[model samples]
Target: MNQDDLFIAEDNPQKQIVIVAMTGHMLLDFAGPADVFNCANRALELRGRTDGYRVLVASPNANKQVTNSAGIEITCTYSVMEVSGPIDTLLIAGSNDVQNLDDPAYQDFYHWLSAVDQHTRRVGSVCAGAFALAKAGLLNGKRATTHWDRSRQLQKNYPLIQVDPNPFYTRDGKIYTSGGVSSGIDLALALVEEDHGKEIAMQVARRLVFYLNRPGFQVQFGNLLPVYDHQNIAEKIRSWMIGHLHEPLDVVRLADHMNMSPRNFTRVFHKQTGIPPAKYVEKLRVEAARKYLEDTDSSLEEIAERCGLGGLVSMRRTFLRHLMVTPSDYRRAFRTSLADVIT
Candidate 1:
C-alpha cells in the first residue's frame, strides 16, 4: 500500500478512486488528479490524521504501457476486470485521438465502464472522455460537460445527454464532468471538499498551488470572438468595438457602420459568429469591465462608464448577470495589476 492507501485505512472507510487510463490519453488529465489525492494524503499527515484516499490506476488490458498524448508511458496496477468493491469515484481520462474511439480496446473499455457504473458510487469524465461515457449510456439524460471543442460532437452523437459546454465543471447527482484537461483538478478538488471538510480541501488546494479552486458553474468558455475565420470586415468592426467599448453602439448605427442593413447584419453576424449582435456587444463590454476591475484602480462608477454601461446601476446588473457578483466585490476578489499595456 502507498502512503495514500495508509492514510485511507485510518478513515472510516477509505474512499477509493479508480482512474481509468487509456491508450494515447492526455497525461495531465490523470496526473493532475493523482497529485491532488497524494497531496491530500500529505495534508492529512500534517494534521496527524491518516486514511486519505485509495487511488488505483486501472486499464482495459494488461502488460502494455499506455502512451499519453505527449508519448509518456503510464503502466497501470490493475486491469478493468480486477476492479472490485465499490468505486467511490471513477474518472475517465481523455485521449488525443478521440476519433479512433472504435478501437477494440476502447470498445471494451466502454463496456467495462458501463458495468462498473452499475457498482460504482459515481462516474465522471475529463475533456473528450465524456464522449466515451456518452457512448456507454452512463451519461444519458445526465447534465455533463467536456472540452468545449467536442461539445457539438458529443451532443450530435448522443442526443440523450444534456451537454453544457460552457461550465468549467458540473455535477448532476453522482455524475461529475469537466471541460478540459486541467479543469479535472478543479472538479477533483470540489469532490474532495464534498467528501471532506472545506479546510482539508483548501489545504490540499494550497499544496497543489492551484490557480483557483473554481466553482463548478464558472464559465469554461472564455470570451467568444465575434470575428470568424479570415473575414477582415467583421474583424475590423470587432476591433473597433473593443476599442470603443464604453460607447453605446445601437443596432442601426452599428449596422450602418458595417455597411449592412439591420436585419441583414444580424443574420450574417449570427451565422458567421454564432452569437447575436447585442449579446456580442454585451459580452465585450462585460469583458472590458472585468479587465478594468482587475488591471486599473477604477471605482465601480468609473468602470461602468468605461464599459459603456452608463453608470453603477447598469454595471452592477451586468456584473451580476454574467459573474454572479456585484461590481465592488468582483473587483476586490479578482483584481490584479497588469504587467504590460498595449501600445
Candidate 2:
C-alpha cells in the first residue's frame, strides 16, 4: 500500500503537554514545541473537534518568571511542583548556561523530574536539555542527542548514554531527545502524528508553516560542508562541487583542482569533512536533483543528467542511499504537499 494512504486520522483524547523552563533556557527550545502543540490543537478545533492538546509552561521557581538565554522574559503558568498528574508528555527545555547542571538549587527539581518521569507517558528534552536528563540518570544506556556543539560533552560526561549528533531527534522507548532548538518542532510534530495521525499532523504543520515531516535521521547538511577544522580547503571544494554539479567530479579531478594527489586529497578531505569526497559529491548532486524535482516538470532521466548522476538508475540509488526514499516518492511527497506552495 502507498504510504500516503496509511495516514487516516483517528479519535484521540486531549493530552496534557507541560514544557519545563528555567532561567537562561533557550527561548526557541521552549516556544517551538509549545507552538507546534498549540497549532495542532487549533487545527483540531477548526475541524469541530475539541482541542487535542493542552500546553502549559512551568518553571521551578516561585516567581514563575524565567529569563531566557537571550535575556527575553517569559512567564510560566505553573510551578514545576504544581503541574498535576497523568501527564501525556513532558518536555524539558534547554539552556545555554552549562553551569545550570551544577547548581545546587536545581537538586530538588531533578528529584521532582525523576518522580514525574514515572507517571508521564512520554518524556523528552529539547537541545541541551539532554544534559539535565543525563544527569538525572534518565538517559542511561539510551540513545539520545542534543545540540551538535554539546553532543561531545554529553557523551564525555555520561559514558553510558549513546550520543547521536546527526539526527534532528531521537526516540528510545518512551523518552525522546531533539537536536538543536528548531528540532523541538520536528519532535512535537512527530508526537502529534503518533497520537493522532499524519492527516492532523500535516494540518498542524501547514498551520505553523513548517515542513510536514523531516525524518529524524535525515542528514543535517546537503549543499553545505560538514563540520570541519580545516575549513578553507573543504569550503573551496564544496563551493566548486555545488557550482559544477553537472560536471564529472571524480576524486582525481577534484584533487587536481586543489593541486594535490588523489590519494592525499581523499585522505585529507575525509579527515576534515568526516565523509569521503565521493560521498560529498553525491550529496551535492542529490541536492541539485531534489531542487529540480520539486520545482520543475523535468523527467527523471533529464534531472539525472542535469545533476551529473549519469543515469536515472544511479540517481535513484543515490536518493535511496542518502535520503531513504526513491526519487519519485520524494517528489510525490514533497511536491504535492503544502510545503510547495505555502512558502
Candidate 3:
C-alpha cells in the first residue's frame, strides 16, 4: 500500500481501535500504541485524506476511573458493557493485577474479550496484558510474548501458549504480544505499516521521534544466562554469594567458608560447575550489578561498590566482558520505563 492508496475514502471508514485499559496497567501499554495510531491519522490528513484510525479507550466498567501503575487515574470513555460496535482492532493494555485470576478487574474483561474475539478484526496485547488474552484462551496455540521477566511464567501458566520472551513484539495469526511498555508502540507502528504501508508508517515514526522501527525478532536483553548446575553447594554457596556481592570474594575465603582447603575446593568446584571459582564469582557480581541497574536508580559508582566491581571503570570493563555492553549502555537499554521518557 502507498500513501496514495489512502485517497479512496469510501473503502476505508477508519479503523475503530478499541484499547481495553486494565486497572493498574502500565500507562504506556495503551497510551503508546494509542499515540502511534493517532500519529498515523495525522500522517493521513497531511496527505489530504481524513479517514485513518479512530482510537477509543475503555475500562472494566463504564466511566470508571482506573488508577495506573504510575498512580495517575485514567477515566475510560466506555466500559466493556457499553462497547457494542464492531471493533476493527482490539488491544488489552496489561496490568500486574492480571496475575491473579480472582482479580475482580479480570472478570468483565475476560468475558467481554472472549465474545469480542469473534467480531474483532484484530486482537493483541501489550506486556503483561497477554495474561488477559491467555486467560481468555485466545492466546492458546499462538506464539506470544510479554515482558521478559514474566514471559517464562506466562508460558508456564498457559502451557498451550508459545511464549517467546525475547521479541519486541510478536504476531501469530491476528494476535500480537509485545515485550514491555514501549514495545507496545512498536507493535502499533507495525499495524499501521500493514494498514498504510511504509511511507505513512515512516511519517508517523518520524513525527513520534522514534529512531527505528525495531524488528520483532530482536532480543530484548542479554541477561538470559545458562542455568548452571551447582551440585556441590546448591543452596548454601549461591545464597551467600548473592548476599555478599558487595564484598571481595577470593578462593581462599570461599574455601574457608565451605570448610575445605582453597586448592581442594577449587578442584571440586570446577569439576561440578565447569568453571573456575574466580570466574564464577565474577559472573555472580555481573548478575548482581545487572539486577541493580535494571530495577533501581542507583548511580554507577554506588552499583559498582555494591556489586564489588572495584569502581566505575572496573565495572564497565567487567560488564563489557560478560554482557558485551557497557554498564551504562545496559542500563539505558534495559532499565525499563523508556515509556516514561516517551510519554
- Highest TM-score scorer: 1
The positional error of residue 285 in candidate 3, measured at the CA in angstroms, is: 7.1
Between candidates 1 and 2, the one scoring higher on lDDT is 2
**Stretches of candidate 1 exceeding 4 Å from the true structure:** 1-13, 23-27, 39-52, 60-63, 81-86, 100-104, 148-153, 166-168, 193-217, 232-236, 292-303, 326-343
The alpha-carbon root-mean-square deviation between model 1 and the true structure, to one decimal in Å, is 5.0
Error of 1 at 137 (Å): 1.7
| TM-score computed on alpha carbons, candidate 3 | 0.68
| Backbone clash total, candidate 3 | 1
* Candidate 2 runs further than 4 Å off: 1-17, 22-55, 68-72, 81-88, 95-121, 145-159, 163-170, 178-224, 227-232, 291-299, 329-343
Local accuracy of candidate 2 as per-residue lDDT tens digits, 46-98:
89988588787888666677789888888876776676555789898977776
Q: Cα-based RMSD of the predictions, in order?
A: 5.0, 8.9, 8.1
Say which candidate scores most in lDDT.
2
lDDT, residue 59, candidate 1: 75
lDDT (Cα atoms) of all candidates against the true structure: 0.76, 0.81, 0.80
Model 3 lDDT per residue over 1-343, tens place: 2433222233667877888888778888889999999999988998888768878888865456677888888876567556666578888888866544447755776787777778777999888889888888899899999987787788888999988877788999888888778888899989999998989998888988884476323342634344655566524588898888888799999999999999998998888777888988898888888888888999999999998999888998987776667888878777867734755
User: 29, model 2: CA deviation in Å?
Assistant: 5.2
TM-score, every prediction = 0.76, 0.65, 0.68
Candidate 1, 1-343: lDDT as tens digits? 3333322232356678878776777887888887888788788889887667778777756553577887777777677556655577898887767775667766666767777777777888878778778878888899999887777778998999998877878899888898888888988888888877788889888878784466334441344343356664456587788877877787887899888899998888777777778987897888888888878887888888878987788888877777667778766666673433434
The better-scoring model by lDDT among 1 and 3 is: 3
> How far does residue 18 in candidate 2 sit from its true spot (Å)?
2.9
Clash totals for all candidate models: 4, 0, 1
